[model samples]
Target: MQFENTREFARQLDKEDKLSRYRHEFIFPKVNGKEVIYFVGNSLGLQPRSAKKYVDEIMKDWAELAVEGHFYADKPWWDYHERFSEKLAKVVGANPSEVTVMNTLTVNLHLLMVSFYRPSGKRYKIICEEKAFPSDQYMINSQVRFHGYDPEDAIVEIKRREGENNFRTEDILQKIQEVGEECALLLIGGVNYYTGQVFDMETITKAGHDVGAFVGWDLAHAAGNIELKLSEWNVDFAAWCSYKYMNSGPGNASGCFINKKYHNKKDIPRFEGWWGHNKERRFLMEPEFHPEPTADAWQISNAPILALAPYLASLEMFDEVGMPALIQKRNKIVAYLEYVLQEIDKDVESTFEIITPAEQEDRGTQLSVFLHGEGRELFNYLMEQGVITDWREPNVIRLAPAPFYCSFEDMYEFGQILKKGILSKQKV
Candidate 1:
């Protein structure tokens, strides 16, 4: 538990790590002929070494079977996405019947809104966290506009207490209550992208429902990085991209969860397509849309087989390792990363203020640190030295020591590199 900033100490921890060997499963980028210590898994995950094989299988199938690949390929392109339901349900803590893979994150959210974001008369306002991911902001704004309401009046943002970096749970619940009868939808990022705060989704979902609002989560960061029980939480709906911690390729397919309560409801409005029709009767091509009695009912088009291939590859790994193992390593590694940052700050003139919540339960793999008396030069120096991290505006660098590939040694080495960068800047 006592984290020391030394290579030996880091190596000792790594030796004790059960997940250490899994690092070899991924292919890392090289800087100056050495694999970089990757910390940007929150932005984009490193390519799974098996991803090529998955894609190649699909390519080979397309070549061999042509249009018949839909029925003849090893994965059978028509039912390709069905492979994800069981594995992905385990990852997000939902039933296989409650989850499905479909379009990208924002696109799924838009489609899900057709079923969940119904606003009429007095119950028209939507409650979301302040400064949500830009894409979410744009989606909410556009959705409100499309429904013929001013965003200023229809969108209720729960602001953090003046100087706080994260929104308090009480503040969020109170805001939901305050929105009250006017709250038609409550959608928030399960883990905040900026501060790396994990919202109390279960409690918030209850609060939203108590106020007669439809609740959902944008799990872009939370899906694989944190433990989620979307079904137990009774979340009405949720969506997440596979490209981040899920380790699918960039802009890959997304996963969704719709509560079983919403399934097979003809009255529930949705933008339907042929894929959502009853599979047994789909070939009949009847004019009326008889929805599939599960989350797949929201599917507006056929599965993107090529896109889902890499995702299936990654999900197999997740199934093999399990989330409990991932979360165990995530907690220890993130704490070690924080300790390394603190140790380096003690030695350097620059200050590293971690804005992420100190509690393990309140945070995930990411540590958003404000580098006082430092600038983008530090970030550039890090990148050049084979340290891949993400930089936000105003001297904040987001370091996500993903448990999948990030080692404890990486934490120690990054501390050394960071200290050197700061000391070198002072000499100038």
Candidate 2:
């Protein structure tokens, strides 16, 4: 679709957008008495208007029922996490029995590693992308150390070729095949945080399984931004935070997916708690633990209902609009933004380059622009001008046009503001 860098064009597109109504669902941040163009859903999502109502209901239950709220509340605290299973399963493409809402992302990763990362005999090495999010790197590094192995020898990083911005799928597959004999697990980000490249999980999962390795993903950026098929891909396990693309509040509870293939495998190891115990026998408080025959079996503690309420509010919205609708708007708006950016690059002789993949299937909502000269200054100027985006070190600015809340008008404005920032930097 041809895109024009005009407010009229953007307004026309917005008028045609079926998802335009969703923009009103979120509370936008104010800048100079106007709402800023919020494009940071890949980091912290904007608060849903219904979030307060959800939390207030929970709080009211606690006030009226006190300890009895566990059983007596409108939505029982005892089974609060269960409410999210079916809706969340749709977002990540898994069965309700295969998905569970619980702990933070990194914590879930550690717990899953206990069962999936078992290194035996000659198969001990873990394959992951180089420069994964720091938390994942730290977790892998510490896990390898905990098992009494040198990280340098136990971890295999697939690095990009010199000066390349993203990993090539062929290179990644070749790396997997190269270390297939020694690799025990293949853990990678479903959508890379920096480059915004969406990995081919189905193929990668198949490659890992064929090579006798377990495969998993960190879906922090992938969960709500792009399509996921953890169940169909036969992924062994996966985890993601709700705060990012899921549009849950900051530090909100996360979701986990464990393929049903492992649900009935009682012999598999995992960290356990009372919440994971069989519901019928939970009240018995028996010494012998009978785990839930589902992904809930991985839970190590009771659900944090207050922290989870906001996520429920967000998930309801996701359920209404669905991923297919969201992905449709995402493609059109992102294409418009890309067109605008290319126009800017041509007209201004841009000092920056977009590091994200050009293919729609290979990327999601974000475009990572690696600014060369005056990048930081231009970023600060845009911030001052009320264009909300994220800045990473080494001169990259990430702009994500979230389909749920962001509008085509916002993208047009971003292009205008970005051009102004560039010109202002030149004058400086």
Candidate 3:
């Protein structure tokens, strides 16, 4: 699709977009009574208009039903989480029984590591990418220490080659093979947070399995942003936060996937809670833990209904639109954004370089631009001009054109503002 750096061309594209109607379903933040050009959905998605309505329903149920809300409320708090499994299963490409809504991402990662990251004898090393999310890094380090192994000896970080900004799939596979005998677990981000690179999960999962290691993913950045097939890819486990691409409110409940192959395995140890007990005998208060034969066996506590309400609201939209439709619009809009950025790069000899992979299949909606020499001053300029973007430390600015609500016009305006910001800095 050819792109033109003109407002009229953007307007034409917006007019033709079938998903444009979704923009009205979200409430955008305002600056001086005008809506800002929001491009931060890759970090925190815009709240759906239906979120308040869904949350209020839960509040009303709690007010009226009180303790009995556990069984008698409209949605029944006792099993409120059961409502999301089917829908979320579809979102992550898993069977309903393979998915469960539970704790936050990092917490779930720890819980899964308990079962999947077991190291025995000489096979105690864990392989992960360099510069994983800090939370994941800390969790892996602490878990390694918990097993009485030094992190320096037990962890192998797959790094980019000199001067390269991304990892090659072949290099990652070779690394897995190189440490085959010592590797106990292979944990990686499905989509890297810093570079927005979507890893080849299927190939990586196969490589780990071929080497006799458990493989899992932290899908915090991939869940609602890119296409995933946890089951088909044979991913042993995965976890993701709901706030980013899923548009749940900040710090809301997260979703987890445990392959059905492990659902009935009694030998797999987990941090058990009463909620994971068999529903039929759960109220009996049995001293023995009879775990559910589903992903629910990993739940360590009761679901937080209020916190999950907004996520349900957003999932309804996903259910209505389907991921295929969303991905369709995503490709075109992201292409438009890339084209706009490239046009700016050419037109102004821009000081920034786009570090994100150029291929649509290798990335999602986000593009990380590394400023050659400038700092946050240009980012501040864009913020003052009503373009809300995400800034990383040092000199990177991330712009995401979310398919759910972001418009082509938004991308065009961002390019215009970015050009102005660059030219203005040059005049300085």
lDDT of each: 0.94, 0.91, 0.91
**Candidate 3's error at 198, in angstroms?**
0.7
* Per-prediction TM-score to the true structure, in the order listed: 0.99, 0.99, 0.98
lDDT of 1 by residue, 248-366 (tens): 99999989999999998889999999999998898898999999998998998999888998899989999999999999999999999999899888888888999999999999999
Question: Which candidate achieves the best lDDT against the true structure?
Answer: 1
Model 2 weakest lDDT span, ten residues long: 343-352
Q: What's the ranking of the predictions by TM-score, best on top?
A: 1, 2, 3
- Residue-level lDDT for 347 in candidate 3: 67
lDDT by residue for model 3 over 1-428, one digit each (tens)? 67898999999999999999999999999976889999888889999999999999989988888999899988898889998888899899999999999989999999999999999999999999999999999999999999999999999999899999889999999999999989999999999899899999999999999999999999999988899899899999999999999999988888999999998788998999999998889899999999998999998788888998899999999999989888888889888888888888886755568889988899987888897877789899999989999999889988887899999899998889889888888887
Order the candidates by lDDT, highest first.
Answer: 1, 3, 2
lDDT of the structure predicted as candidate 1: 0.94
Clashing residue pairs, candidate 3?
none
Q: How does model 1 score by TM-score? A: 0.99
Enumerate residue pairs that collide in model 2: none
Superposed Cα deviation of residue 272, candidate 1 (Å):
0.2
Give the top-scoring candidate (TM-score): 1
Give the poorly placed runs of model 3, Cα more than 4 Å off.
none
